[model samples]
Target: MADNIYVVGHKSPDTDSVTSAITYANLKNQLGMKDVVPAAAGEINNETKYVLEYFKIAPPVVLNDATDKKVILVDHNEVGQAVDNIMKADILEIIDHHKIGDIQTGKPIFFHNEPVGATGTIIASMYELNGVAISKEMAGLMMAAILSDTVLFKSPTCTDKDKATVEKLSKICGEDPQKFGMEMLKAKSDIKSKTAKDILFGDFKKFDFSGVKAGVGQIEVMDLADLAPKREEILAEMRKALESEKLDMIVLMLTDVIKEASDLLFVGTAAAKEGFEKAFGGKVTNNSIYKEKVLSRKKQVIPPLESAFKK
Candidate 1:
């Protein structure tokens, strides 16, 4: 195996996932691991692009397959959400902030898992713990990741640690967290030229709900008005994905960050409909549900759906 280690995050790369990979790899390199590098599992989204541009940091190279490579995972632990062909790779370490999913290694490795909001929060703290002074660029990236994942501290998943990390990072980067965060969100929300498919899969994930295969995507915007016109078009794309992917259910969460709510759009089999109802008690109208205060998919959406499908 190559001695070079690629630090990467989950597919459908969010700001937290992408930034954590870069920040963590920098930390590893600073600690004398010269071969450590950062990589992204998929295309960088607009919000992340804004962050990278603001910090004058380049995006990591995209790594589609991890076969025969050494890797340290960030942001996510689930095999289904990992880079392609990851099972054939040599796992080194995992740093995540979500409930652990199935990703096993032949040997024990450095696995850091916390319930904090963003993986960046953990990576930022690791800089302090390792006695490395965070650079301005790294601080900006970390702050953006925390703000993106926490929806500027409005998400239910946002922890005190995440808030503290962002507060510290903001000072180091000399950017007001709220002001920069809103600008970043505006970048994400501007989907004027994006295809319906692009908007749907820009931040999507796949899951096994019991025996059912489900796909869920989320797009966070400052105003839901931006999506109001394209709702039908997006729903049509969702239906297409449902059949083309052979998924039992496909869901899209059009989240409004300012309002802290989501409009859940889905297309699925009858069984999937039943499970959806079981997950969130509401009548699905026009194949959509308006959920107030539903922001974090990792925290709010997936858990109940997983349980609902199992029953």
Candidate 2:
């Protein structure tokens, strides 16, 4: 385990990523572990920004690069998937729900990654086990995060703990899941001036996935139709990104914030296509579009791929 733990989350961070980092940072600090910093790879989305503002909490620190500190990658561990602004960490431990990106440690890393719905739930459990007092605001943030990521425990990635946490946190936060979900979606819906390319890869990640190179980028907004027109533009940008970066594959997730379905775009060689087909069990086309069962990467994409990689 690394002495300095820099807790971070996936790119284009949602509430779960942001809240979990804050809570985890607090825990590590309370445990007398110095140098625990909460960080994010992308700008806070409108809904997440609202959550932070409502709780009177400042946003999590933006991590320009994950390699900047001794990494304790949270919510995501893809070396390429996190902020390119990275500083080398002496010790690295990862606790994420997303597919494990290529993680390289001179020594072994403490990895606790699952396909659970929300990283917030995972971190919440850790806090409960440690018996830390989570403030109402923190609880709200954490709960909101879990709810958003798992679509209020509807996403396939959701677990009993996620549901339980949201239920418990809802009481304290004074938020009804149904009501809050509506409000949250509204917040994310008002997208202005964002191009399809901008929306798609704004919080892009790149990594060395074992021997294979890969990248993951996401666009989470209210309606898929808004992004459809710019589909060609998005694909072009992602295609260039993969080619120039020399990645084996690049996965673009166009998630419908409303329907909870995503069209996965896998761009790369035959090996990358075969990897996705074998892992996700869907037909891969000549181009990159593959319909996926779930929209959220934390719940759907990461878990299956993890299971596949281990096999």
Candidate 3:
């Protein structure tokens, strides 16, 4: 293993990805590992930016590619979501909460895959396991990541461990979980200033299953009705994305945090529509489907779509 390592998260980085990478890197350094620097596979999202600025921590260096570098991945294991040139890098470790994708390595590596809501929760337990004290800033960042990934503990992906970790972390950070979580979510609610491309790709992920090239993007808002006016514009942009990316299917999930529901917009082949209808059991009118209690894309969206594709 190389002495100098880069800790990174997946593309279109979210709060959990950013914080988990930094926190894990810090933990490694505290345990006598050196030069385990944190990096981001893509641009940080608004919520992550808010958390980093609130804690007065600088964002990680942007790493577009990892050719011939030693790296540790957090928050994602999918090759499509990974840093460019990941196949050429020496992957030493992986700590992630999402589904494992088609990632391969030439040598054996340390892997920690958990079912927790956020990668930060797993990293928090690692701090205890390693006997490293969590600093106030680290606590705050981890808290932000947990709250963001779990949607204030409202998403179906949230586990008891996530809630417990956030309660303890909120105390260390000296912030009320509910109040601070709302503030953090509000920071990402404003989308008027973002371009169509930005809105679509802000939290996008691509998946390949059984020869199906699918992309799913999500944006959380306080109110789904607030986005009604821009529906056509957004769908048009999604269509353009599908064509440009050469995807078999593309889905954009407009999530209402308060309502705990998601309105899905899709554009793709006829088989894609059939697959969605079979999996979701609803008519996709005007290229959209309003699904109640559909929040976690990993749990609710991808699994069903994968099942549908197999048929």
Best by lDDT: 1
* Candidate 3 similarity to native, TM-score: 0.97
Note the Cα lDDT for every prediction shown: 0.92, 0.71, 0.91
Candidates ranked by lDDT? 1, 3, 2
Error of 3 at 118 (Å): 0.2
Where is the poorest 10-residue window by lDDT in model 2? 302-311
Q: Model 2 misses residue 142 by how many Å?
A: 0.5
Q: Arrange candidates by TM-score, highest first: which order?
A: 1, 3, 2
Question: Predicted candidate 3: what Cα RMSD to the true structure?
Answer: 1.5
Give the per-residue lDDT digits (tens) of candidate 1, residues 21-68: 999999999999989999999999988998898898999999999999
Model 1: colliding residue pairs: none
Model 1 misses residue 130 by how many Å? Answer: 0.9
lDDT of 3 by residue, 24-55 (tens): 99999999987899999888988889999999
User: Residue 6, candidate 1: how far off, in angstroms?
Assistant: 0.6
- Summed backbone clashes in each candidate are 0, 16, 0
For every candidate in turn, the CA RMSD to the true structure comes to 1.1, 4.0, 1.5
**Candidate 2 structure quality by residue, lDDT tens digits, 1-311:** 23455677767676777788887887788778878978776787777887788778888777775454676677776555566654364446778887645666677767888767877778778777888777787778888788777765667777887788788778877878778777876766555667766665654665454467667677666777777767787778778877787888888877776676777877778877777777778777745555645676655665565455453
TM-score of 2: 0.79
